[model samples]
Target chain A: MKIGVIGGGQLGRMLALAGTPLGMDFAFLDPAPDACAAALGEHIRADYGDQDHLRQLADEVDLVTFEFESVPAETVAFLSRFVPVYPSAEALRIARDRWFEKSMFKDLGIPTPAFADIQSQADLDAAVAAIGLPAVLKTRTLGYDGKGQKVLRSAADAADAFAELGSVPCLLEGFVPFTGEVSLIAVRARDGETRFYPLVHNTHESGILRLSVASDAHPLQALAEDYAGRVLDQLQYVGVLAFEFFEVDGGLKANEIAPRVHNSGHWTIEGARCSQFENHLRAVAGLPLGATTRRGETAMLNFIGTVPPVEKVVALADCHLHHYGKAFKDGRKVGHATLLCADRATLDQRIADVQALIDA
Target chain B: MKIGVIGGGQLGRMLALAGTPLGMDFAFLDPAPDACAAALGEHIRADYGDQDHLRQLADEVDLVTFEFESVPAETVAFLSRFVPVYPSAEALRIARDRWFEKSMFKDLGIPTPAFADIQSQADLDAAVAAIGLPAVLKTRTLGYDGKGQKVLRSAADAADAFAELGSVPCLLEGFVPFTGEVSLIAVRARDGETRFYPLVHNTHESGILRLSVASDAHPLQALAEDYAGRVLDQLQYVGVLAFEFFEVDGGLKANEIAPRVHNSGHWTIEGARCSQFENHLRAVAGLPLGATTRRGETAMLNFIGTVPPVEKVVALADCHLHHYGKAFKDGRKVGHATLLCADRATLDQRIADVQALIDA
Candidate 1:
């Protein structure tokens, strides 16, 4: 089947990589003249909101899906008129904006950190007075990888925070002292069959995801799946969804949701029975979901800015390198490596070795 | 690294599928406009012997390799002068002809069926008289999937066999009353590092491979590896090679060697720690070879003529579908399904289910 992807980044590249073996073709829409994924499929070098390009892509492919949730909902709505779009415009509309996502979680009885919509300085001040200090002030939309957000650590810090955030519609969220951060990647088919990959423990450095380790049996597994299930069913979501959470004092709090294939689940490419990229394609293509069982002790390391030497990575045992074929730039995600080890000790050792290489 | 592959068939398609994840680009040389692998890489729509196209490919790629040994030795010899070519022209020359292959096996102390060269009707008669009735008369070059040859069960069957085979150079071989057929796929790096996949028990019908099951510990695995090692070393080969054998009287008689990745090794895509395609690329690209350990109870089912419905094949547990994206034709291999199960019984059950679907 011909699939139209709304973004031509690593995720779309990976989607094409996984789907190509299953006899699926892809067309990606991205403004970059050399979007990394353009190599894998037909690249429509156009903006997401380009009506002519959207129409052309819709006419060419059987369905449409985006690699990132930041795609404007109107773009998806426009494409939906010409071709089926997975995960729905409603899901993207809700997930792209922080307030809508947190409100939806609250509406669905999923516990979330206390949050309030901030339209002005008065609203921000009121939210801070009510929710107390040490809150995060974030733009309502267009934020990712910790961008467009600021920590209000003191009353003085909140003085110009609203104005500092471009005086835009925003969300003021009470910060949780979380012991750990985790994400659950779930895929719901068109027929409503849903499967959840094991909850992944994620670590971030400077607000960018650095590592993710798949859990075989995390204590919060059921809770994470339950939370993700609620979101999936609430939106009638079709295709992969990633929901992040903060582990609180023996409980979980919803952080956010991404309405697309995510980085944390990258380990599934080598560490699971079927990769998240393949499952996302299967789900979006109206095919049965593949098995989500974890294959071994697995962890994924993201290569920020620069990918380490290829020979060093491939020479390591049980390590699979996935280079995105993008030019190096500071803070850019150039590639990643998935290590599938036989045991936790081995995984730890390999992770350290890879970490050392990345650091070097 | 950029790779130039001659013969844009399913094998080239698979090689691209495996290599794409490793940040490699591909260009395929084939005369067919709709070559199955063309979708995966840049397709040079020209014959293998087209010098201008070969030179263009050699100029573009870091190294060159062919998916099939039938690529004329002269074509490889010509390309090698411009760019590095894996497996060398000498390797291709010996492998593309049955006479050279068998003679090499004999020289390497690898067991083989009694064989003799045939150039004319008199030569055919002498070979038949010496090798006895029930022997097979096969063209020495350009034969595959049970094509280009005929089995001579008696003197009557040998009447016009030479003329019938286009009077090409031929080999008459005494048929082996073997218990089964098996193939060992091995990869040799430029530095002489070699790794062998476990022996695969294969079954064929009408000379087309129907099924292959990976043996975790076949008794003759070492023997097969030893014979393949000799061939690899003899050729100073780089990249993947397959050595087919007849399991006769608890021993292996070399049937032939393919200088490229073989169909029998398809199971390694999902069943082995690293796929043969990826290892072949690693070898040709001068990168480190990946681990060759088996993942689980694995077997591959070839979809000859037509692929079973994708929905049905994928619905089965642990069944990974690999469609070649080729138009179906009688006796053509259009797709395959790899069944990876946790145990032998489960694999057997899954294989039967997939077989039933194919049979349907």
Candidate 2:
């Protein structure tokens, strides 16, 4: 099958890699000609907003999917007229806007942080009054990797936060003091059969995902799976989806949903029976989903800004390092390393070994 | 680094895939425009015998390697002027001819079955007389997967066997009663460091490899490793190499040497710390060779002509299937499935499951 990907970033590159073994051809479309996915497939250098390019891409491929949420919903909707877009334009629309996504979650009886839309200064004040201090004020759209958001510690911080965000529509969400953050990577087949990978406990540094370790220790692992299943069913999602959540007071609260395979699930490439990208392809290609069983306890550490020292990293026998063919940039995800081990203790030691190399 | 591959079959396709994560770029030269590796990299369609094309390929890449030994020695030597070819033209020349290969093994103190080269009918008669009855006659060159070889029960069968192979240079060898056959997949770095994966006991039917399972029961496992190391060092080879050997009377006798990665090592995709393809890329790209530790007891079954039933294969839980994108032809290698398990018993059951699916 010829699959068209709307963005040509690392995720698209990896998706293309996964498609190769399955004999799936791919065309990656991006505004930049040098986008990473170009290395893996035929890359079309055209803006997502270019109707001609979208039409050409839609005409060429059997189906289309997006690499990121910021891809215009109208583009996806228009392309849907010519080719099937997995997760649908509706999923993109909801996921792009924080308020719409949270409201959808609440409507579906899924737990989410209490949130209120704020359009004006008066509305912002009212939201703060209702949700209280220390709430997060985020732009309604185009936010990722902790961008387009600010934490309002007090009434004094609210005005500055609003000013920083400028005229963009926003949402105020009451803070959930969670013990940990975890993400569920799941895929729903065309037949509505859903498969869930083990939940990954994510740790972030400087607002970027630093590490994610797959765990069965989450109190809401079962509940998270059920919630992801319901979400995919409601959306009729036909590819990999990641739902990020916070474990607060022994209950899970939805944070956000990524409509495609996610960074937190990168460990699956080495640690799962079938990788998330491969499973996503299987779902979209109408093939039966392969096993999601974890091969062992695994951890994935993001190589942001710089590649860790190779000598030390390679010395750790179990670590599998994947370097995305990308030039280094500050805070940019250049690559990741996954370590697979028999248990948590071995994984922890491997992680420490990798971290020591990175620090050096 | 930029690496050039001289062929674009499944082996080159896999090498391209393995090179991606290592930050290596590849250029493939092949006469087949639609060769599988072409989809994965910069493929230049040119006849192997064209000197201009060979020189252009050599000028464009840092190093050149052939996916198959059938590549002419002249092409390798010509390219060596501009770019290094791993395993070297000398290795290819020796390995390509059965007579030269056996003589070289003997000179290197490697054990082999009694053999003699046959150039004409008189030479054939003499070889048969010297080797005795129940022997095999094979072409000295261009033979693989049962092609260009025949077995003789007695002197009465000699004319027919000779006629079957046609008027070609041939070799005659006395048959030995062997308990089993095994192969060692080993890699030699340019810096001369060598690493060996565990010896795999291989089972063949109709001269085509059917299955390979790792075995500790083979007394020659250690000897195979040592022999492989010595052979690679003698050849000064740099790349993954497979050596086929026979077990008879509790001793291992050298059967043949494949200068490139072999089919028996396909299980490394899921059954080893790093796959043979990946390690091959690493060695050719001047990167550190990865650990060759086995993940678990593993078995690989080749999918010849038709794909095995997916449902039955998937039921084996940890079995991973890899289907090469190729037109199905009788006795052609279309793909393979690998099963990884905790022990031999589980692997035996998995193998049975795979065989049943193939039989069905």
DockQ for all candidate structures vs. native: 0.78, 0.52
- Backbone clashes (count) for model 1: 0
Evaluated against the true structure, the overall lDDT of model 1 is 0.93
lDDT of 1 at B336: 94
Classify candidate 2 by CAPRI docking class. medium
Clashing pairs in 1: none
lDDT computed for candidate 2? 0.86
lDDT of 1 by residue, B309-328 (tens): 88888899989999998999
Q: How would you encode candidate 2's per-residue C-alpha lDDT over B59-104 as one tens digit per residue?
A: 8888998788878877888889888888789889988999999998
lDDT of each: 0.93, 0.86
TM-score of chain A of 2: 0.97
Off by over 4 Å in 2: A309-312, B160-166, B308-316
Query: What TM-score fits each model?
Result: 0.99, 0.96
